[model samples]
Target: MRLTILALDDVFDTGLTVLLDTFSTANELAAAQGNPVAPFDVRVVGLGRQVRTALGFAAPVEPVDAVRKADWVVVPALNAKLPHLLLKALERTDVIEAVGYLRAWHAAGIGVAGACIGTFLLAEAGLLNGLEATTTWALAPLFRQRYPDVRLDDTRMIAACGQVVTAGAAMGHLDLALWLMRQKSPELAAFVARFMLIDKRPSQARYIVPDYLAHADPLIERFERWARSHLADGFSLQEAAKALSVTPRTLQRRAEAVLGKSPLAFFQDLRIERVQHLISLGEDLERIAGQVGYADSATLRNLLKRRLGRGVRELRAELQ
Candidate 1:
C-alpha cells in the first residue's frame, strides 16, 4: 500500500503517531514473515516540510505533493478543542487545498481514511455525503449538521464507505490502522495486534453520555434541561411539549433532528445514564433502580439490556 499521511497544523499528535508507528511495525513484521505479507509504504506528508501541532511541537514531513502518487491518503485527528479546531480548520488555506486534493485523489481511486475530528475534513470536502461514516462521538451533532447527507453513526468505532473510511474518537486511529492492515493481510494484522497489545473495540456508545449532544441546538438544549429535571419520575411527550410551549410534533421533530432519539426513549436514556453515574460512584443497584422509578433491579436490568445491549454489571464497569 502506498500510504500518504496528511499532516496539518494542530494535528492530534497521539493519533498521528499511532498510524505512523503501527504501519512502521506492520512493514517490519511483513518483512520478517516475508512472501504473502506485503509491506506498507507509509509516507507522512504535510502542507510544507513541517507542520505545527497544537501541543507546541512541530512535525516534519515530505511536501503535500507526495500524495499525488499515493494509493491511500490518511487524515489524522485534530488536537485542539473541537469548537476552535473546527472553526480554525475550516478557515485554513491549507485545509481548502487539502480538500481539493482529497476529492481528486479519491476520484482517482485512492482510498481515504480519517480518524476522529479528521473525519470532518472528509465531510467538509463533501466526500462522505450519502456514505456511512463515524466521527468522534461527542462531535456527532456538528458532523450531522454540517453533512446531513452523510449517514452518521458514531456508535461504531469504524465505518467504511467503499474506499473511504471514517473512525471514531481519539484512539480510533489504532482501530482504523488495524482495519486497513487487516484488509491487506489478516494474518499480518493478527501478528501486529499481538505486538501492539491492541484489541478490537467496535462501539463508542457505552462511553457516550446520553443527551450530551442535545445542547448544540437551542430547541434540543431546552428539552434536555427539562428532561433531566424530570428523570426522577417519568414524564409524557405531551406534557413535555406543553412545558416547552411547543406542540408534541414539534418536540418530536427537534428530538429526531437534533439527538436522533424519540422523546420518550430519550427520556429513558437519560434515566439510564443517571443510573450509570450512580453506579460509577458505587451505589447499590436496587437503590438506583428505585430512585429512577424502576420497581426493582430486574426491571432496571431489562432497561439497560434493551437500550445498551448490556446488564447493569457490564454497563457500570464501562462507565466507571
Candidate 2:
C-alpha cells in the first residue's frame, strides 16, 4: 500500500523544511533496510500554486485538491506570530472549501495528523473537540484557554490510536512518524530510527519526564542529573543530600515534589533498571551484582526474583 502524504506548507518555510527532511530521511532508511513497506509519496500543497513563506521565500505548491486522494494528510507547524494577512487568507471561503475536502477524506478513514500549532487547524475544523491531544509546550496554555473541552497533555511527545493523531512539538514529529511506521511495519521503524541515530527503544517515561521538568528550578535539574549518574553507585538519600549540601529530609521532600517518589525509592528503581540492562547485555550475575552496587550475587538474585518475578537465568532467557 503506497503511503500518500499531503504535506501542508503553512507559510512557514523553515518548519516545513524540517518536517520534509525528517520524513524523507525516515523513508530512505526504511527502504534501505529491505523492509517491504511502500515508500512515502510526499507533496507540498498550499492554498495556491504559488505559496509565500514567513521568511519571504516563495515555493511552488500543488493545489489544495492534491490532498483529496492522500492516504495521510499532515499539517506542519506554522509561525507562532499569526500574520493577520495569512489568517485572513486561510479563513477565506475557498480555503474552507479546500479544508472540507480534507474532512471528507478523514471521514472515509484516511489518517490525519498535526504537529505543534498545526493542531489548531484540526481544532478549527472540529476534529479535536473531546479528544485527548497535545501541542507544543509553550502553546499549551493558550490551547487550553481556547479549547476548553479538549483534554490537552503537554507532557506527551505524541499520541495516536487509529485514524487521528497529534504531536506535541515539531521535534517530536519525527518520533510520531517513526511510531506510525513501526506500527504499520516494524522493520521499517527500526531501520529508520537506526539510520537517524536515534535509540529505537526510548521509553514513554522519558518523554513525560522532560516536560514535567520543563519549569523546574536549576537546583532540581542538577540534582536529578546527579542521581542518574550515580544510579549504579547505590547512593543513599542521606549521602545524596550531603553531596548537594541539603538535609536528607529537605532532599526527600524536594525529590517527592519533582519526581513523585521518595529519594530512596527513585534510587532503587534506577538501580534495578540498570541491573536489567546489564543483565540483558549478558553480564554474569556475580559481576552484575557488584557493578550495580548489590552486596552479592545471592542478594541480587533475591531482589530480581522479588521485584521482577524472575531469577537471573530466567531474565537472561527472556532477553534471548
Candidate 3:
C-alpha cells in the first residue's frame, strides 16, 4: 500500500518515530514470513524538504508538494500538548498549509489517520465533523469546545469513522499504526504486534484523570470539588447547583458542554475514581461501596464494570 506519513514541524518525537518503526518492522516481518503481502510504500512527507521534531533533531523528508498520489495519509502528533499551545500551533503558516493538503488528499479518496494532537489538525480541516473521533483524553474537553460538530468519544483508544481514523494520547501512536496495518492485513498486524510486545488497549477510560478534565471549566472544577467532597453522600442535582450557586439547568449545561456528560454521570465517574483509590488501599468491597455512596458492594461492582469494563478484583490486581 502507498502510505504518506505527514510530518509537521516540531512534531512529537516518539509519535513520528513509532510510525516509522512499526511499519518498517511490519515490512521486515512480512518478508521473513515469505508472505504474499508486499512491503508498504512509505514516505515521510513534510511541508518542506526537511522537518524539525520536538526534540530538536532535523528529519529528512520529501516535500508534500512533490507527492503525486497516496493511499493513506498518516498524521503524527505535534509537540503542543496543552490547549493554549496547541491552539497557537494550529495557527502557524506551516500547519495551515498541512491542513489544506490534508483536505485535498482526503478529497481524492485517500484514507486519513491521526493520533493525539494530530487529530486536531484533521478536525481543523473539517474532516472529523459530524463523525466519531478520539484524541488524547486529557485534551478532550478542549477538542469538544473547538469542534462541537464532531462526536468526540474520549473513552475510546481508537475511534474510526469509515476511512478517517483517530487514536488517543502519546502511546496511542502505536495503536494507530497497528490499526492501519490491520486494515491492510489483520494477520500481519497481529504478527508485528506480538513481535513488539504490544497488547491491545481497547479503552482510554482507565488512563483518564477526571479532575484534570474538569479543570477546563470553572464551574466544572467547582462541581468536581463538590462531587469529591460528597462522594459518601447521595448526589442531588439541586444541592450541587445550590452549592455552586448556579441553577440546575446551568450546571447541567456547563457539565455537558465542557465534560460531555451530565452532572450525575460525572458524579458516577468521581465515585468510580474513589472506589479505585479505596480499592488500592486494600479496603473491602462493602466499605468501598459505602464510601462511594453505593447501597452495596454488588451495586458498586456492577457500576465499575459498566463504566470501566473491569471488575473490582481485576482493578485491584492491576493496582498490585
Candidate 4:
C-alpha cells in the first residue's frame, strides 16, 4: 500500500512517530512471516523542506506535491492540546494550505485518516462533514461548536465512516495505524498489537474528566456543581434550570450546544464520575448505587456497564 504521512509544523511528536514506527514494524513482521503481502510504502511529506515538531526538533520531509501517487494519507495531531491554542494553530497559513491539500486528496478518492487534533484539520477541510468522527475527548465541546455539520462522537476511541477514519486523543495514533494495517492484513495488525502491548480500548468514556468538560460553559459549570451536590436526589431538568436561574428550555439548549448532550445525559455522566470515584474508595456497590440516585444496585450496575463499557469489577481493577 502507498501511504503518505502529512507532517505539519508543530505536529505532535508521538503522533507522527507512532505511525512511522507502527507501519515500519508491520513491514518487518510481514517480512519475517515470509508472507507474500506487499509492504507499506510510507512517505513523510510536508509543505516545506522541514517542519519543527512540538518538542522543538526538526524532521526532514518530502514536498507535499509529491504525494499525488499515494493510495492513502494520514494526518497526525498538532501539539495544540487546549481549545484556544488549537484554534490559533488552525488559523496558521501552513495548516490552511495543508487543509487545501487534504481536500484535493480526498476529492481524488484517496482514503484519509487523522488522529487526535489532526481530526480537526480533516474537519476543517470539510472531509468529515456528515461523517462520523472522534477527537480528543477533552476538546469535544470546541469541536462540536466549530463543526456543527459533522457528527462528533468524542466517546469513541476510533470512528471510521466510508473512507475517512478518525481516532481519539494523542495515543490514538497507534490505534489509527493499527486500523490501517488491519484494512490491509488483519493478521499483521494483530501481530503488531501483540508486539506493542496494545490493548483493545473501544471507548474514551472512562477517561473523560466531567468537570473539565463542564467548565467549557458557565451554565454547565454551575449545573455540574448542582448535580454533584444533589447526586442523591433524582435528576429533574426543571429543578436544575430553576437552581441555575434559567428556564428548562434554555438550560437544555445550552447543554446540547456546548456538550452535544441533553442535560439529563450529562447528569448521568456526573453520576458515573462519582460512582467511579467511590468504587476506587472501596465503597459497596449497593451504597454507591443509592448515592448516585439509582434505586437499586442492579440498575446502577447495568447503567454503568452500558455507559462505561465495563463492569464494576473491571473498573475497580483498572483503578487499582
Clashes of each: 0, 0, 0, 0
Instruction: Write candidate 2's Cα lDDT for 173-211 as tens digits.
Output: 666667666656676667667777765422233233332
Write candidate 3's Cα lDDT for 132-172 as tens digits.
99999989999999999999999899999887999999999
Q: Which residue pairs collide, candidate 4?
A: none
**What residue runs in model 3 are displaced by over 4 Å at the alpha carbon?**
none
TM-score, each model?
0.91, 0.56, 0.97, 0.97
Tell me the deviation in Å of residue 178 in model 4.
Answer: 0.9
Overall local distance difference test of candidate 3? 0.91
For model 3, give the 10-residue run with minimal summed lDDT: 63-72
- lDDT per model, in order? 0.85, 0.65, 0.91, 0.92
Q: Score residue 253 of candidate 4 by CA lDDT.
A: 96
Candidate 4 on 1-320: residue-level lDDT in tens? 89999998899999999999999999988888896765799999999899999999999999987789988899999999999999999999999999999999999999889999999999999999998999999999999999999999998999999889999998999989988998888988999999989998888887888899999989999999999899999899999999999999999999998888999999999899899999999999999998989889999989988998789999899887
Return model 3's CA RMSD, one decimal: 1.2
Best by lDDT: 4
Give candidate 2's error at residue 304 in angstroms: 23
Model 2 residue 213 lDDT score: 47
